[model samples]
Target: MLAVPYPYLIARMRGLKRGNHNYYKTLRNYTHIVAGSPFAEKVMRQAYELTGTRIYKNTALPFAWDLLQEERQQQIRREFTNYFPQSEGKKIAALLVFGDISKMKKTPFRNVNMQELADSIGKDWFFVTNSQELAEASYVLPAEYRERFGFVNRIMPTQNLLYIADSLVTNNCRFAGSYAIRRKPVHVLRYTGNVFEKYVQEDYNDMYIGQIDKEMVKIQSGQMRPDQQAFCKEMSYDNPKEPYGVIGEILTKPF
Candidate 1:
């Protein structure tokens, strides 16, 4: 697992912080965008700063946040070495999970379609449900090249699923883990949402931070086994639907 440096964009946003309430509010909104918080004046301001328009107010904030995350992923790839082997001489196939995206009603399987779109662009492509699906799907390929493509299980969370999906489209090998075994001309991108959100709080210097730090230390020292990392990846301050949350009533309209 190569560590990608946090984007300077984040640091630049954070640098705008001042001790004043207005400044803090601005910072909070900027963080909200990254955390997929609902729309607010502050969030709108941050979006304008980044995109020069208020397009996100009309679009879903999760999608907007995903775009930002994709940009960050690109930055990571640019700065880090290739982790997966080369795919120059072989064709590739991808298997993606249709998780919550399938439940969206409006954009179900949009990501899966995106994968097909990538394949149409040039790369040989196929889609399957699981490892067994891979085996069944393989028989459809030409006999000479039946072994050139591989299957990947799409049993991970959404966030990790996108990472693997991005890797497949870009032909980045660093994310092609053990699924590359058998030299079957295939690559695998397993979804791992176990560490989806960590460190999503407003105050990192508070007692909560100390407690989190202690838990992290325990995990690092092998004294504990956590199902997921101790971190908050999303912010809910602007979401009116969230319990005990408050964003301005004016911002809650379905405009």
Candidate 2:
């Protein structure tokens, strides 16, 4: 069973409380799946049973889009450039592929074109709605542009897709992670208990890795900028024995 940290869950609930009208509407829709009417205890129970946590089903997409907004996107771009200055002048592409363009149109996926977007960004970024469409888009791109573009397929299993999508948003709209393969096709899977479990575990692992990264920054603080050191400290791991001991062992080994 996937267990989100209590703080994360509480923060999500707080966001839900402050969400806009559409967020509530989406919540209401999901709440209807249970025995009782929306917002009833039975509905909540059903939600817990299905997802292992209470979350507004519809809020994730909008939240993802919010993270992809112009300001956030630019911030992400800036961070990326700062980290990889050599990529500063490179074009970032974004492509969106969809199983049913019509269905996407009804949602935030409306009017987004993979090719046009790639051209607009003037970067090696691409977003695709589905794997098949991504393949098709890759085939049609101009030879020059093709080399600079990267594709993001959205048709992963719903849960995995949402997790990836959320990460993309949280990570300044960058696409990462893997989706399942089906006969060479890919589909987004809806969020599920197991998927959520994996998501939490992955996040925890990322946090732990980030902590270790911070310790490295501290060790190199004399060489790193003050601001960089500060940023690294925030991500520092709580348990340093493992890392410290490993390094000590390596350095002291006779072999």
Weakest ten-residue segment in model 1 by summed lDDT: 224-233
> Per-residue lDDT for 147 in model 2?
55
Best by TM-score: 2
lDDT of 1: 0.27
Each model's lDDT: 0.27, 0.30
Tens-digit lDDT string for candidate 2 (1-255): 111122333233333445521222224433122111112222234323342233322111222233334565565656545543544565322222222334343433222354554454344332223334445656666766565433334323322233222112112111221111001111112112223223323433321112211221222112333432232222221221222333344357464
Residue 95 accuracy (lDDT) in model 2: 23
